[model samples]
Target: MIRYIKNIFLGIYCLLQGMYISMLNMIRPKVTEKYPENRGRKEMMERFRGLLTMPHNEQNEHKCTACGICMINCPNGTIQVISRKEPDEATGKEKRVLDRHLYDLGSCTFCALCTIACPQDAIAWSPVFEHTVFTRNKLVKQLNREGSKLEVKTGKS
Candidate 1:
């Protein structure tokens, strides 16, 4: 009889403790984002990796050397670096130039290996995460812009 009474008291104490916690939470400010309503004001965290991009300068020049390192480093076959032989004006010798840099967003795991492995810092993650698409073909992107040329560093500092 005594043990039963003690169990009842313990259960009431536990119930009161739970209620206290619930009351405390109810009085606190809401942390849940309003989502669609607050879409304009919504901001992604700084470290969020959304998509891969190749940055170009004001002169429409990029630092990618078409080394194929990014493609090789990718765990999946998400990156493709196509190159073509062109005659260098200064040396008058055949040089490999980047014809295209293709990135398949559909297959990419966003492991960031390609960006990390790039020796030229050619690739980076874009903050824009809106990737809604009707077809998978749309996910494949050409990183290099038309008429964009490789930015070669001049004299060593």
Candidate 2:
């Protein structure tokens, strides 16, 4: 009988403790963000990895040599480098030229291994994270722009 009375008192104490915690939290200022309303004002952190992007210069030139280093390093087959042998203008010899650079964003884990392994520093992360899509086909992106050419750097005199 005494043990039963102790258990009842203990139960009441636990209930009151839980209620006190709940009351304290309810009185505190709300930290939840109003997402839709604050869409423009929403600021992502500096190191936030959002999307893989290949930066092109004003001349529509990119640094990707189609070396396949990025494609090889990707844990998931996210990156595809398609190249074709074209006659070099300067050398008059056949050279590998990048035809297409396909990036499957749906399969990517954002591990950044491809970016790190790139010898030409071809790929980087973009801050734009709004990637909500209904179809999987929309997720596959071509990193290289149409009519974009590989940038060649010459030794400065």
Candidate 3:
């Protein structure tokens, strides 16, 4: 009977301690942000990697040389390159042409492998990460646009 009474007293003491801790937590300030209510208005990080944009020169021409290095180096095969052979008038040597460069951003890991592998210094990572699309097809971007070039040399320093 005495041991039973002692155990009940100890249990009560533990329960009171737990209640005290929970009450303290309830009064503490929370840093959790309420979502949807603050959507689109919130600021994004500076280093956040988002959407890919093709860069253009003053003439609005692309600089891609149709090199297959980027396509070969991509781990997920997210980049596709189409090349055409044309004869150089001065050198008379058959030069590879950059017909098309397609990039599927949906499967890209943003590891910057393609950017580093390009010999012509094509491809860049843009700071626009908030691209939420309804379908996966919308995420693919064609790099070899008529007036737009890949800004391989210029990016956030």
Candidate 4:
């Protein structure tokens, strides 16, 4: 009979303790995100590897030399470079022309492997992290700008 009374007191003590904690939590300040409030520059860091961008000149022509090294180094085959082989009459050899430079941002790991592998130092990270698109086709970016052949020098002169 005495042991039963002790257990009953212990259960009441535990119940009172839980109620006290719950009452304290109800009075205390609520910690929750306020989406309507502007956080200004104190925003959360966006986690993404991001896609590569070709460095352009004043006229927006890419610095790429149409080298196949970037294409070979890409682990996911995200980059597809199409070069036009133009035959030079004087040199008796075919010279490469930058026809198309396609980049699939979705498949890219952004390991910067392609950037490092490039001898021409063409590709770079452009600070453009927000690349949200409804369709997968929109994610594929073309490096070439129409009608401009302006050159971009990467390394020191």
Q: What lDDT does each candidate get?
A: 0.93, 0.92, 0.77, 0.78
TM-score of decoy 2: 0.77
Question: Residue 155's C-alpha lDDT in candidate 2?
Answer: 93
**Top candidate, metric TM-score:** 1
For candidate 1, what's the RMSD?
A: 2.3
What's the lDDT for residue 125 in model 4? 66
Q: Write the per-residue lDDT of candidate 2 for residues 1-157, one digit (tens) a residue.
A: 9999999999999999999999999999998889889897988777778999999999999998999999999998999999999999998999999999999999999999998899888888987789999999999999999999988797951
Q: Against the true structure, what is each candidate's TM-score?
A: 0.84, 0.77, 0.62, 0.62
Residue 155, candidate 4: Cα error in Å is 12
Per the 3 Å backbone cut-off, how many clashing residue pairs does candidate 3 have?
2
Output the worst ten-in-a-row residue range by lDDT, candidate 3: 148-157
What shift in Å separates residue 49 of candidate 2 from its native position after superposition? 1.2
Per-residue C-alpha lDDT of model 4 across residues 1-157, encoded as one tens digit per residue: 9999999999999999999999999999996757547444334435334558777777767667787899999999999998888776668898787888899998988888888898878787665556789999998998777764427445884
Higher-scoring candidate on TM-score, 1 or 4: 1
Pairs in clash, predicted candidate 4: none
Kindly list the per-residue Cα lDDT of model 3 for residues 1-104, writing each as its tens digit.
Answer: 99999999999999999999999999999968676787767666665566555566776666687778888999998998988788876699998777778899
Q: Between which residue pairs do clashes occur in model 1?
A: none
